[model samples]
Target: MSHAHPELRTPPALPEGGLRVIPLGGLGEIGRNMTVFEHAGKLLIVDCGVLFPEEHQPGVDVILPDFTSIRDRLDDVVAIVLTHGHEDHIGGVPYLLRERRDIPLVGSRLTLAFIDAKLKEHRIKPVAREVKEGDELSLGPFDCEFLAVNHSIPDALAVAIRTAAGLVLHTGDFKMDQFPLDKRITDLRGFARLGEEGVDLFLTDSTNAEVPGFTTSEGELTPAIDTVFRTAPKRVIVSSFASHVHRIQQVLDAAHLHGRKVAFVGRSMVRNMGIARDLGYLNVPKGLVVDMKVLEKLPADKIAVICTGSQGEPMAALSRMANRDHVIRIEEGDTVLLASSLIPGNENAIYRIINELTRWGANVVHKGNAKVHVSGHASAGELVYCYNIVKPRNVMPVHGEWRHLRSNGDLAVRTGVDPSRVILAEDGVVVDLVGGRAKITGKVPAGNVYVDGQTVGGATEGTLKDRRTLAEEGVITVVAIVDADTGQLAETPDFLARGFVSEEATFDAVVPLIEKALARAAEEGVGSAIQLEQLIARAVGSWANRTYRRSPMIIPVVIDA
Candidate 1:
């Protein structure tokens, strides 16, 4: 297999009738999925999405796919073809549209509705074209067809793009759920037909490639959820992704069957479920769904709440409830169900929430303890089945970490695909299709673009590193007042520390060191306040590292008084 290496050079110009594929994100990671396809001097984007900030990326709201590679060529873009409405697939659309609002968005009906609502919040008026299974459209030099695919959310699709160079199929996050709640299974027959037509390259979802068997069907969860509703002594609170209409449908059914009224909590949960109900994607029985205020008046056993924060986000509703900061408290006898798969790196936060809710006398149920969730991506068996069905000339794994991508590539190889035809490229690695082969040509500028509270691309890696330093080792500020003529210490260098050794006396030894450094700098002709500040910062940093084995954020203020 051709793998992306660190020494890969910048890609050369596209050859005549050749197609270039550059993934900005969602390779080597599970979120912020964006890809750029160029053919005939026109660009077709697929899945502009966002990655949620982890514990290390403090104060960041969401991370975006760095658009540096395509920023200069936004005018050549035809449309952004979204295969689904999951946040990992569509959350970055508004940010991308902010750059070029005229770029048309193409997706299924429900997918478009979800994005439309999201765009409304950004005050963007999108030019949207809704397409479903079997719909074919031509944009510039690329002909695209949509195929139905069953996922956790409704109206998910897989797209096929045809150009003069070759045909590329992108299976956006999907699983072959034989018994989907909506009775819609993955379109394997459509995939077979596409294979017959000759797929030059296939970009498959690799999120669950390491799992051994077929994913559990969504239909099987009904009984498990019903059992929870029947056995719980008090109100049951189910947490999931707000866009998971199918899972919410199961919760609503279980609540109705157990003679309970369901109320959608959390702003996103209420808004999305309202949209799903209005659009008929979510079936709500009359009188079974009630307002939060109305449900609050009912007895605890007669009420059920559906909210977000299944991933343990600190600001989410479920997290606030666990912290006792939300209006709905986790009381004794309450049953809490976390109905989602745990994203990697969030295990600690999820377990913390689980422990907190358990401490509050609530019986917390999650994927570890019950059949509350199933993955939305195809496992190894299903991927092998698709490999046999499509049998593309070249295979590229998308939407997974390195291990998952490697496993998916191995699965394709085991299914008889030549190992050399497997392209293992991460974000920014450029792959080109020419002469009926896909090869890693070079690389591009792909990095994290942070969103920090109404600001895009404002917070950088340096800022996050400083935040982590402050969060971990804390900050220490040193103020040095120097003599104007002699450059000597005017006052004993004052020290104030937070998250470090807080006692002022703790810096008594460092004060003499700062004075000595300032005097030495003066004798060496370092007269400027900036130079003095730098000297003081180094002195304090050195002292802290030597004394406490800590390298905190050191802020030095030098005043020539």
Candidate 2:
């Protein structure tokens, strides 16, 4: 546990001096984001989040930050700040706040509100403070101000964190939306003000840095959705991110124009609508917002259902509906609008759900067919424009793939930010600030912690590699009988297998071969508990490779030993 922020020039550990930016996640990959800003004796964290790995990850549900590096100095962590209401920005609030219950959570009104709900979901209400444009706060050694920014979600903010070295402007998931539903442009003037104030470090969004041109506006999605629903013959069902109030509003407005009463289907949809309605962010007619249970009885043409689970999440309403397991089913003429992009690693699941929905006689509309979803990240030109406006002394792109980060480093260099200050870091790398100059400092104990439904454990790079190999090679469980005296094996091994049967109907054939292979080992006997287990596991693995054409994860269980 040394340096924190991902620094490309980092040593294996921190240099033990100066200001350091330690990022726990959101460097090598996209989610489970945690970043540390340490200067003097004070520390600040930006956006603790978790990543939801693809299905190939046996039982993991959400992935969170590895807090080993900063756990001892938890009290030094003055604030856990938020950038937006997106899952990757706010999902880890409850988990982190549960441990550091006294720490203050700060963010914009909407962002804070969303975090409040998330914390409540875990039965934890964090101490909260609101962040808005033009408000400044000094906590310990950190001075902070918020700038309003436009993204897919409302009330997205970029933080200009002030330190003795200078300001670190963090562009929190922003895009230049000229005609947004909020109708607020990306706050370039705020960044310009920071530039005037002298920002020493700039941690900007790299999600779209590799993509050319400006990002598409949320407003552009209107006419496309308008056309699709207008021409549709039956009810329109839309699914997207819960924080995407703009998208939800678009669907609602389109439904309103088409003489349909919107029925919110998922828990998140209902909850977000309530939040939006309470805050005057969504203007739903009194009777338009019917609950899912009530909407189930309505005619196909009269009600439009908006839900979550556009990415084929099994628990999502769309997934359940596709499988005919939802309270309401899509009939032959119903239209299902997948109002979200397919996250990488979820393509197959999404397509499977879409195909299922199609087979169930419903029409599934994606990006090509309907004006459904658009990205909320800024493109290359916008990032360049932001750099020019901020004119920071240092630039380290945050958020996105490696290509995006590298592209941004090149872009900032081209925009006159100086190549020496361009820091490209992977996860856990730290950038140290010395004599007002920022450079790659070191590394830290930062990585993803694999979380099961109820169990949380640290996951290493090796875990993923093993999971991939096992997924491809299959698995074998060997049940062997061992004698308690002298820890000896007593009889032939019993075997079972699942994934790698060349003939699914004849999978039972695997057991005979494995039994014959391990019978010799058992006859030879085991000296110790470890020996028995290893012997059975090795025999099962060998038998699996020879007969099944692939190595199975050999699980050896000895009975009566």
Candidate 3:
């Protein structure tokens, strides 16, 4: 496919010999990993991704990066380079494609396939250029070299962008696994060669910088998974991230070896596996895989299920099964293995599900209980190794929380990189690399845009606050009909309370207090609907706080008769 976009022929307005590196997201945070490389007014975007919502962001579907910086500069964008196919790295492509469709997407074959599958769901046919390891592409003044890297998923890449100023290396999410499942180890030699050529700045993944030693390889988990398959008394159900094709491949291998038929149990699990298998990234034995319905008829000891919800997502398959609400039930002698890392904030929900599975007479195993999981990011030692190999003049830690970034920076200093050369930045901070030096230049618009239901960037903080208030304190709505001019009460006020009062007796008791307050407000000669609403709201709010020791959201609706 042609990777060139001849339509973007406008000459860029170059900065004074400096290349601007703007982190739109994925700095001092876990996900939504996007960065903008601007040189001579030409922009190249790296990894348009999204962040999953937290508990506090009630009703939000997903959180996307604020793209205000590039909204007006869509014409200047040359191409978008994807480091991997993980949702956190490519989830925001649909949103970006909506803004501009002509921008060429550059990534590995499988990465482009994953992106194509994702965009198909949005009914978008994107212009993608598939590039493998060692491929070079030049967009405007920026020349990029795609280098192979070992990550949880296949076809992960680290990008080295050569600008007029210097070469900037961005090590996407990677770990130094000497014996990777695919035998495609991270290209250390490539990094070393780039270092010898003199790299100006290095952006590295810091997700596991707090970890001390090297991260274990995907190959290491095979034996442990084999033991699970060999020892499990009945059905083996494994939970993992759907994007982890290597883990899924291991699971399939184990199942096939044990003569167990495999069945995928989650939406994303089935979809991603199908895509991977079709694209030859995942190997599946014929007739070894069966449909979900066929799984029900198979003997318990002869079936293995790979599913999502390793983090205990409420709507996920494993969570539903744990709650006894799924079509497939967890029975006695069944084993459920969580072959994934526990995300930091999801411990409570994950443990709750584990406890529920145990209560249902099923054996549950996880990273806390077994050696079935390993992190995909490099640790402190591996970060030290990369820093030594690249030997960049400046190091910027990306793709981590604050503590991880700080720890990664500290490791770089310990690796003989000068402390002055370590540049610490958060999202939206502009780091300019020029004259063989890197420094924070300025800031830009950076924050999360919440996706709620069908709306993107529609859920504001105020909307979330209202949802939280309604969830915690309930709502009390009072409807009153009054005279148009005089604001005199035409009838008695009607009160409706939801979640605040469960019993009719409690509601009846509160009605008299609300009535007395309304009567007093009418007697006080309220003149306007707004004035009466404020009066009744204050009265009802005070009564609820004093009498019930509660503060429900009091809403007053006045109608003119």
lDDT minimum window of 10 residues, candidate 2: 1-10
- As for model 3, its CA RMSD to the true structure in angstroms is 5.5
Instruction: Score each candidate by Cα lDDT.
Output: 0.94, 0.79, 0.87
RMSD in angstroms between candidate 2 and the native structure over all alpha carbons? 3.8
Q: Best by TM-score, which number? A: 1
Residue 308's lDDT in candidate 1: 92
TM-score per model over all chains: 0.99, 0.90, 0.92
The order by descending TM-score is: 1, 3, 2
> Residue 411: error of model 3 in Å?
1.3
- By TM-score, is 2 or 3 better? 3
* Candidate 2 lDDT: 0.79
Instruction: Give the per-residue lDDT of model 2 (tens digit) for 312-375.
Output: 8888898899888987787888888888877767898899988998998888889867666888
Identify the leading candidate in terms of lDDT.
Answer: 1
- Candidate 1, residues 3-104: lDDT per residue as tens digits? 999999999999999999999999999999999999999999999999998899999999999999999999999999999999998999999999999999
- By lDDT, the better pick of 1 and 2 is 1
Off by over 4 Å in 3: 1-14, 481-492, 501-526, 542-549
Candidate 3, which ten residues in sequence have the lowest lDDT sum?
1-10
